[model samples]
Target chain A: MFLIIVEKSNEVIYIKITKIAKAGTLESNDILIMVMPNDSGNIELELESIVMQQFGDVIEQVILHKVKEMGIEGITIKAQDKGALDYTIGARVETAIKRAI
Target chain B: MQKLRRTMLFMPGNNPGMLQDAAILGADAIILDLEDAVSLTEKDSARILVRDAIKYIDYSQVEVVVRVNPLDTEFGPQDVDVIARVKPDTLLVPKADVEEIKLVDIMLAKIEEEEGYLVGSIKIIALIETALGLETVYEVIKASQRMVGVLLGGEDLTADLGITRTKEGEEIFYARNKVATVCRALRVDAIDTPFTDTNDYEGLTKDTARAKSLGLTGKSAINPRQIEIIHAVFAPTEVELKQALRVLAAMEEAEKEGKGVFSLDGKMIDAPVINRARTTVELGQRLGLIER
Candidate 1:
């Protein structure tokens, strides 16, 4: 089971990724992700929605979105994961975006 | 004096993916390993791979260190000879017993003399990974003037001690605390072992904080993702920076007034506090937190 919790504000976005697997260690079986737009838009929510819709099919998606109704310039995400997360897989595309920003 | 080195990231000698990710990880140093990470059958190939990576990679900001195979290994001396020739920032000697330290010192001295290189130009970091090694940390740290740091290799230490490497680092606490204290007494850098569970941020953060509290100058990173956490733990926060600056200013003011002692924020300030302030400034400079 995997869980994604997103808390958004005018200044930052707090994300917590929780996952559990048959494997004892998270070294190779799990993925955690968070994303934000570089140029500032409703991109974080959009990105979160897109990721959830895509990987939601393969992995569990317990996503919680907390979008601020005011000025938001940057995004900050924290992913607390339980399994091995890859950089290229669907679960990590948004994470790559976060790293890029 | 050099500023503290906070994050030392490890890259397996033969893993190109890890090597490629290292320089951009924002770690203070990158330790390319040719030891335990490589199999006996792949040792020679790993050495070549490490050498090539060193020669080609920019490593513009990160200090580069190569963990050569242990002295007893057939490939160990050869690994050192080749790496010393290339001249990375430092050489990390594994299983650094007293004998091994003496051996590496002699070999490095010989190489420096034969090649007309500056004697002791390359820094040495002795990794204490075995029970025997832990028993002789002081002698090992003192064996060579080229020694810049001492690293605790907990995984191997635990294996040697026949214990499970736990998350709390209890099994290796004695060794870890000993190495760190020894380094502090010797006035050299001490590095903590990596937390192998790379994905566990809570675990990693908690461990890094513990390592920092033990007066460790740095902690090794098993993955690029661990760099930020390590850096944040070691980096001077705004409060620390402000206090440091105040203490420094008080000292300068006292000197100007011809007084030997100064009071800062209603507390007497002395050499140790001043030294800490100066170190904070140096760290900020080295880390680019402020304009030099």
Candidate 2:
């Protein structure tokens, strides 16, 4: 039964999960990212940051860039930022997505 | 190419504050740690952070060493990939043995070729943390032409020996001595492990003194507070510096007289003595203890 399911190419294409996968810490200069599967093929990002007023768009772009780099789509990311750098944000999202998959 | 490695301070790779200020901490080398310092889930982030840190930070004269994950782990290859591109001064390989050191050397060569980096420019610091690593220390040190130093990992080595860790460092005495001996024999730097008790200034001083007594070139520092003590312990004292200068003067006079051996303060100054005096003078100059 498992082999038949794996053999069907279309059956494995949409294997997405609704479970929330989290990565990173709430420590200063760190960000926590939670990722979950979404069916609409749209990336919904909810960012809460201390520097949201100034760096919001840049942070969003970084997260999106990382997600695209991983070729991920149809996922919702909840990024709780505590003034994290671009590298930290990307790492958290990458780890969250890996855990989700 | 022996460099000043008196104090190699380790900072967690993910901590931006630490990374930003690493250069100003006055350590001889700044080690951005991507292994034990980072949690499992944060490994990717730490690597990325370290990669960017290496690119942007002005380490000035302080050498930058990145402690990458063990080659057997999932993050190791990724860590090396970034490290190769970033090109830190050295890579510290934890739990390193002969084969692992050789493997990383090969991997680094390949990465250097691919990235157009100078082959063997990035050096290797084999962190001997396992019993097997300890047993194969000679082979591990000899495995790579890029090998610049060997660091003893006390905590893991103690665990491997099933012995208790202590502040006095009695448990790691044998391992430290062995590493120092091997390093001296192979003409590479021997770096002692960090003193875990960050707040015990007296103990830290004593531990560093013990390392110096064992003829270790340097010791790792977990905190900035320890850097001064390590440096002080390793620096040539004024009396020693004076003696070294006198020896040099005596040797120069002997050379003028076409003599191979001479005496200073009623003691024979032969090759070994002259060599020691030269090392003392060089170290004093390097540490800014002696006017160049």
Top candidate (lDDT): 2
User: Which tens-of-lDDT digit does each residue in B1-292 have in candidate 1?
Assistant: 4735788888877565566567887788999989878888657656755775677667877889999998897999999897887678899999889889889988988887777899898889999889998888989989999898998999888999898989998787788788889998998999999989988998999898888787788999888899899888888888888788788777888999999987877888888889989888778777778666
List the DockQ of the predictions in order. 0.01, 0.28
RMSD of 1: 17.2
CAPRI-style quality class for the chain A–B interface of candidate 2: acceptable
Give one digit per residue, the lDDT tens place, for model 1 in A44-63. Answer: 32222234445543333322
Model 1 sits at an interface RMSD, in angstroms, of 12.7
Candidate 2 Cα RMSD (Å): 6.3
Question: What is the per-residue lDDT of model 2 for residues B1-292, given as tens digits with 9 covering 90 to 100?
Answer: 4689999999999887788789998899999999999998778778877887777768877899999999999999889988778889999999999888888999999999998989999999999999999988999999999999999999999999999998888988889999999999999999999999899999988999999999899999999999999999999899999999999999999999999988888999999998999999988887778888
- In the range A1-99, model 2's lDDT, one tens digit per residue, is 000001112322433545789877788878888888877666678888889889988888898778766766678788888988776676677768877
- Where is the poorest 10-residue window by lDDT in model 2 chain B? B52-61
Positional deviation of residue A4's Cα in model 2 after best superposition, in angstroms: 42
lDDT value, residue B84 of candidate 1:
82
